[model samples]
Target: MSKKDTTYILNEIRNYLDKFNNASDEYYSFIKLSNELSELRTTIQRIELADASIPYINQLKKQYDAKEQAYIALYKYIKHGLISSWYETNKIIKDIGKISDADLSNKNKQMQYLNHYKTLLQENNNIIKPTLKERIAYSLSNLIRKR
Candidate 1:
């Protein structure tokens, strides 16, 4: 491979690694948030039992349940992002490894390789299918902002 082509692959790998790291960080955040929310729900349940006579306690319990479900859904979305990023990173490394053994000295061959690389990136982009929870969260956020 030419110097430029080698540089391109190296840069792509570096950027992909950064993305993978970020996704991992977000995944950790999601876990932390989920745990905290679980604790909050437990506390709420305890309170609901202690103050069962409160007139609005049932409504409060229902809202708390909805919030807990939303957090669980968000956790799923972040976990999905983490797993997909890891898979894509591994695939990128493998693809780059294969490139190192190929002949790319000819200009036409180099162009073909570049095109193939673009196609691979496109495929990776297409794999980020949003979960239903993610779509709903986005919709809710947008609705709130419209006020």
Candidate 2:
């Protein structure tokens, strides 16, 4: 996919939420958001697996990496408090053991899990968005391992 795809998808989500109106439009918007998020997830997987020696592909990858970081920062800025609080996120994990048989059918429990899941997405984005030093170290390790 083009480098702009993910950024555009994220911006679409942000714009929709910012201008959100008409409760009647919510159902369709939610469905569209779900599909876009699914697509974004797939695009992320592809970005992670992409490998190339060509200069153009390498350049595109770097641009995508930068864009991803910007997109994440913008998302956090725009959707402040949309992600669950860190304490709640941690508490949910702790409380999971109290859940008998991991019953997800309970709407309240399910909402907790969903919030926890979104918190994880935020945390995972922070963790996985590699820094230049980390990326260089990874490249060196790969080269060493191949020898």
TM-score versus the correct structure, for each prediction: 0.53, 0.23
**Cα lDDT of model 1 by residue, 1-147, tens digit:** 566856677577667758767877877777777777677678677877787666566666676677778778877667556555645655665655555434533466554565466456656654664566765766676589798
lDDT of each prediction vs. the true structure? 0.64, 0.47
lDDT tens digits, residues 20-124, model 2? 343225445545555665566666556657753466556655655665665566554333322222223344434433334434334554434544544554565
> After TM-score superposition, what is the CA distance of residue 1 in candidate 1 from its true location, in Å?
2.7
- Tell me the spans in candidate 2 whose CA falls farther than 4 Å from its real position: 1-52, 81-147
Q: How much is 82 displaced in model 1, in angstroms?
A: 3.6
Query: Which segments of candidate 1 are over 4 A away from where they belong?
Result: 52-56, 59-63, 99-147
- TM-score, model 1 to reference: 0.53
